[model samples]
Target: MPSLTLADLDQRPELAPAVLALFAAAPPGAHHLVCGLPAAMGQEPTAEILARTSGMLLALSGRQVAGAIGICPYSEDQVTLWGPATAQAAVAEFLFTSTREALHLSRFGSMRALIDTRNREQRAFYRAHGFAAWKDNHLYECVLETRTSTGTVSRGSLAFKVRAATTRDHNAVISILTRAFPDSDHCLPSLAKREADGYRHYVLEEAGTVVAAAAVQDAGRRGWLKLIAVKPELRGRQLSRRLLEGVLASESRRGKRTMALEVLADNAPAIALYEHAGFRRKWTATIMTGPV
Candidate 1:
């Protein structure tokens, strides 16, 4: 097999499909974030977009590909790998070799990949490649098989009203998030696209202002809690928990059986809230960072 080249991704508009297939073939819950743009955007990724977005994906004669990295905004220091796969040893050799070559010239400081929690082989592969486990950054999952008996009534001392967010709620949500997670940049695009895709948002209103908010994206039998943020001044009031419960309750009622979310390992408060609310650790993914 020839060395993987940037020209391959440019030629394959079905790159997203191929990657998705790889994920499915691996095991359940193998990756937290998809490597490609959301299908809802109808964005056919271009070579320029790939190179600009993170690093370029290299491919070899349609049999092998590698050296793909996705820069995540949640963790600016890390990159996610989406490498080549083939049954041919030559193909694997080409992919590994190209990956090493790309690493030498890559601008990123760190790179990592999420292997399935149950797939020991894949996890070992990652370890052999020099990636270590980031024990603190664990993924959580909650099954909605049965709705929690918890009522939708707001539980906090803060006087707030829960309502569906409207067009008027965007700026307020953005402001709240900016204040809550000063370093995070993952949600903006997804939030913007929610408006375009017609996803419903839940907001907590206090004194006629949206203080806490969360967005829900329909994912078949599962519902994704995309963004959950609260104002800084209201930190210890449990407003975020109330808002999350309200959203989860509504999603459960709508036949969404699972709620999934990702949080930084160091965010103790947020992780505590999720645990208290019945979310359990499912897996962990590392964010590797180097230079650019």
Candidate 2:
């Protein structure tokens, strides 16, 4: 008889393969398991770095992994869930029960998931589980596919050159981030663990001074674009378009079919730029909070 079970990923390292399979089976543009699993599948999950070292679990039908759930701390009282994928009712219920218990154990007051709106089944599942839309997250993809004749490269009215970043450029990248996003809402592994981080990093410099930067990390078959920021004073020069093109072109050449990133609901200008570049809306991930 196949009995439902729940276990931490560390307990069943072999389940990584099955877990990756579940992610691949989702909608074309669905965000794969963002934690535990490799940025790209077929590779091993980063055991030491997933889920902020808190609540992470795998659902099982006897010995076979059926699904998984992860809780990344968003604040002292809040957590961000990664999965609860396209799973069966009983499977999801078990995962949710395990998740809630894990949260209570960890003392977190609220929990939320950034769900993809395009995946109707998953969206319906979240709603059924009492998750609500506290806000909207726009996920866009395909940097190269969206290229227009208008030229994706930034001519750099200020005379800037784009190139791969090195350790020496780290502080500059941080400086630009501080100035451009004083209340930073986005987080990247590079910022958290650059030493072991695998994401390819790039930077745009004007007269030898780093002014803009972007990053791309492999997510199994696709690539995820991280933070792309420009100095406030240089925003009008289309530096963003150039930096994105430079990053996307590099990744596309590597044979990655698509690239993706997320922006908050109110960031219309950034969404417009991505749309102009040929990137389409893959889905909207809702960050549901409180009891659900």
Candidate 3:
């Protein structure tokens, strides 16, 4: 068992491939959102994304690579490990070493691995390694294959104007998200980057003001729906649904096959809206936190 090293990820592209292979075998409607990187040479950016945000490491068992994990600095004493898993103890040992290397690279505090709810075995492994349950999240997947539009609701019926977001609409988009979900720490930064990444933002305007908004990130055959928020003053009028439907129809027109998103498990209203609009439960992810 060799110590895990950053060089491993650079040297062995198979590690990511193996992870993707495993994720592809996941249950139907289950989204391996964590492994959303390309399984090719270009995957270096995915690795770099983790390394730059936190730090990354790869674990190897002899000539056969085992697994990999990435850690990012969050708060002063907290580090977030995005993807961490290894089937072999030697590989696990390497994972631990590689994480330490990430800490050295970032000069940050301690680290914890973010695990998915479906990977109970991996979760147990992390617990055995002294990681505790820190945060819980639900992964919802709409069965795009089963989606049948109940016919588009009239925009006039909802009294909301739904339209595609343009660069000119950036300020309004940001304003809606900030006002609708003021405490959603994860979504705010993502909203900022969507514009930067060239994804189109969509808004639902009411009385000349943006009341709800969402963004679509094109993932070839699949599209990611994110930054969904409705203004506080305009909650019950189905504004969010209109915005979501508008985005979905636009994606459908573009020939995208699937649309996916993650929502808080406690948000029943949101879950209902998604269900009503043809989205179904896919999987769940837990956000584990620990002291740095």
Candidate 4:
């Protein structure tokens, strides 16, 4: 085997293309995994998204980029690992160990990696490194069709409207998201920053009050449904379906060709709702976490 060398991508900016190719050339059961970002099959990470990472560690073997890893800080206490993307299995551990050493991993409380369920080798590798399988997440997507109209729906004398949220709706949307995902870093104080990053929030309003909400991250022809929630008091009312319909309608109007999202494998209600809406599970991943 050739001797491997590691370099910080920022310092060796010229190696960017090879690092990207390492990710693009990923094969089944060894795909490059990025967290806190939307990446569908055939989708390549954009420069803007790469720029969000705190570090990119590249492994080289005689001028060839053999492996790479991108570190994205998710919060003060957690960071998401993008990859130990390597040309051969022999380099996976070297890439991961070098990354931990290069980035001084101890500052974070934990690290996470989301790997395709089929990647049994990678799963076992992480386990050997002290990571535990947290849960399975299913990635679902549906082709979208243009719609001419959408309006309030009525069910048993109750009517609700679904539409893109306005500035005035920010508080309500954030409140619902905060309540729904209390531990999430995507809500509250970060909402404005996220909106600036092209996330759009939609709401289902009943009598002028936002009853259900969803946040979408638009990527040209596709939208990633990041989070969706209904006000707790109205869960039995099927408001989630209504809000989802509205979101689809809105996305269609914006020229989106598809919508994708990830849901917990155990979330039966959410799975059924997406399935009923024509979304099909494309893949499953195990979210593994380990102390840093």
| Runs of candidate 2 exceeding 4 Å displacement | 1-4, 16-25, 28-56, 59-67, 72-78, 85-87, 107-109, 118-130, 143-158, 183-195, 253-257
**Top-lDDT structure, candidate number:** 4
TM-scores of the models, in the given order?
0.66, 0.72, 0.74, 0.91
lDDT of each: 0.58, 0.65, 0.59, 0.79
Clashing pairs in 2: 39-219, 39-220, 40-220, 41-220, 146-277, 146-278
Model 3 off-target regions past 4 Å?
Answer: 1-6, 11-56, 70-83, 104-112, 143-159, 183-193, 196-198
Cα-based lDDT at residue 34, candidate 4: 39
Kindly report which residue stretches of model 1 are placed more than 4 angstroms away from their true locations once superposed: 1-22, 28-79, 84-93, 96-112, 115-136, 148-159, 186-193, 197-200
Question: Across residues 170-269, which tens digit of lDDT does each residue of candidate 3 receive?
Answer: 7777777777666544344565575676466888777666677887766546677766888777788777877787777777766777777766677888
**Local distance difference test, candidate 3:** 0.59
Per-residue lDDT tens digits of candidate 4, residues 1-292?
7898888888888888777777766643455353444443335665655666888888788888888888877777888787787757668888888766755746777888888888777788889989999999898988888554485677666678998888888889889999988998787466677899889988999877798899999776788898999988888667798888888888888889899898999998889889987899878888899877
What TM-score does candidate 2 get on C-alpha atoms? 0.72
Tens-digit lDDT track of model 1 for 89-159: 44444555565666567555666654445545545555666777764355677877666644345335645
Residue 204 alpha-carbon offset, candidate 3, angstroms = 0.7
State which candidate, 1 or 4, has the greater lDDT.
4
User: Could you tell me which 10 consecutive residues in candidate 4 have the lowest summed lDDT?
Assistant: 33-42
- The superposed Cα distance between candidate 3 and the true structure at residue 143, in angstroms, equals 4.3
What's model 3's lDDT at 229? Answer: 80
